[model samples]
Target: MNIRITLDGKEIETTAGTLLVDVAADNGVYIPTLCYQRGKPCLGTCRACSVRVNGNVMASCTVPVAEGMTVEVDAADLNDMRKALVELLFAEGNHNCPSCEKSGRCELQAVGYEVGMLVSRFPYRFPPRTREHVAKYIWLERDRCIFCQRCVEFVRDHETGRKIFTIDDRGTHASIEIDVALADRMPPEQVREAAELCPVGCIIAKGVGYDKPIGQRKFEVKSIRERTLERSRK
Candidate 1:
């Protein structure tokens, strides 16, 4: 059944219990997201899709629309909050965009530009993180990982149905761990899929390096906003 909701002060009719983020997107609203992928279970890890629902701030990807729910998506304060999240990610991680392999296609970089992030307000930690290239077909660039868990949750061992990528430790010491044996056994296409699944340049295929020129890259060809809205509608 279709239910009416107020999104950015505009009336929108959508299916009841549909995810708030999808509802907004289907109605021509753009909510920046990192961990939440459409048609997949919501991870709510990134918290970039924050929005006001009935005067309460929450992750829109994890929220379900209710009748007459008032949503504020285009508010200045909300945008600033998202901007801070993006900036903090930059400050915490070693995202050297110019030198990184996924500079143009990286979602973190794209979202940062979308949120108007000139520079991070927080101090850069520059934590010592080592890049892993031992896996036969994949490279784990720990420095660029934002811990979105898309690979850990979505991409799994095809036959065993076990998590090929897992998180080690907890809190500040937490790190992403990949099963070298499992990763090696994966088919070439699956390896490429896992690499592409990552939001940043963290998990990458070994053989492929700077394959597409800068101008012909993913985000360069079309803005994240355009691709996101196009995907959401589908």
Candidate 2:
């Protein structure tokens, strides 16, 4: 079931119907992603994974490989598109990575660094958001959320499949919520899972965070690009 496609001027052979993200990674092409994880349903909420396919911009995680397709993952315009998406997320929320507990390990911050985003192109809103602390093990910091919907879709009630996180309001006023009653019943692993699911610092585990010193945390040691691109160079 091998299919051939061209990526950035090079020919790549991969299985048909394989996700473009997986195909790119297998062929030493790195495409940034946030809301798409292996084995989980893709939300495509964040357009960070966009790549140009046959001259059209598409979310790579949602597209499958096709024979004779020409995929562009490293075009200048596509890179700028990814950068703009990251910058918009920064301007839309109160990331404040320097003061946040998830500073070094935060994916959004790592992505900003990877994309060379020195400053947000859009004006900062500094929008006021309420924090939810009702959950015993996990809490919500609305200001840091990017509405990725990872927890809402993946971290459901272990038994009944009820949503543990949801959204309220609409558009600019919308915010994320945690089902306190259901969250309280979540096992310790699920509590950690929920916190880790967040690409930003919005979802936090009560007893963790702020423990790692600066320049010593996950992404701090090695940037996301280094992790993704270095392997390709090998």
Candidate 3:
């Protein structure tokens, strides 16, 4: 199926199932994303990839292309919306980027910079922190979760092949939960993958802090798109 869409004022042709992010990238109009992973399920929870489709804000990761579809990437209002969303995420979580090991490489930090979010407008919640100690090598920080569910989905589908992780509670109290009460039940490699899959530093490897150093990290030299494409090829 063929779809003709106007992206950033240029008409482009794409397939029916093409995601808005990929479409924009194919046309050299990059749409910022944090929760979206290529070749994975579309979570659409992170509003960072939200774009103006015809006139309304929608998650570009999940939005399908259609014939004659008019889409705007990085429009002023859309950028403001994205910036506000990033700020809200920052305020809701314990994202001390400067102190985090994932500082320069963190997707949240990169997106925040791309959207020009200098200071958070919303009051900080400073919510009580919680941690999940999984063996001696993995820890899950509930306070930093933006509820992206990349970990939950990845662990459930890719690693365990079972519904091991789930989101519990609702609306500001929602959290990721493991099906088993015991921590470290999942393999260490799988746990590592899940932690790395998280867009933010919500989940982290237990002992591998700052091993690469500041000058050697992937994000330090390459854009997120470049990094992501490189990973995809590998």
Give each model's whole-structure lDDT.
0.92, 0.87, 0.77
Which residue pairs in model 1 clash with each other? none
Clashing pairs in 2: none
Count clashing residue pairs in model 2: 0
What are the TM-scores, per candidate, against the unseen true structure?
Answer: 0.98, 0.95, 0.89
Number of colliding residue pairs in model 1: 0
Off by over 4 Å in 2: 226-234
lDDT of 1 by residue, 131-170 (tens): 7888899999999999999999999899999999998998
List model 3 lDDT by residue over 67-114, tens digit each: 888898767888888899999999987788767767777788877877
Q: Where is model 3 more than 4 Å wrong at Cα?
A: 134-136, 157-160, 179-183, 228-234
Candidate 1 lDDT score at position 177: 94
**Order by TM-score, highest first:** 1, 2, 3
Give per-model CA RMSD. Answer: 0.8, 1.9, 2.5
- The best-first sequence of candidates by lDDT reads 1, 2, 3
Q: How many pairs collide in each candidate, listed in order?
A: 0, 0, 0
lDDT comparing candidate 3 with the true structure: 0.77
Which scores better on TM-score, 1 or 3? Answer: 1
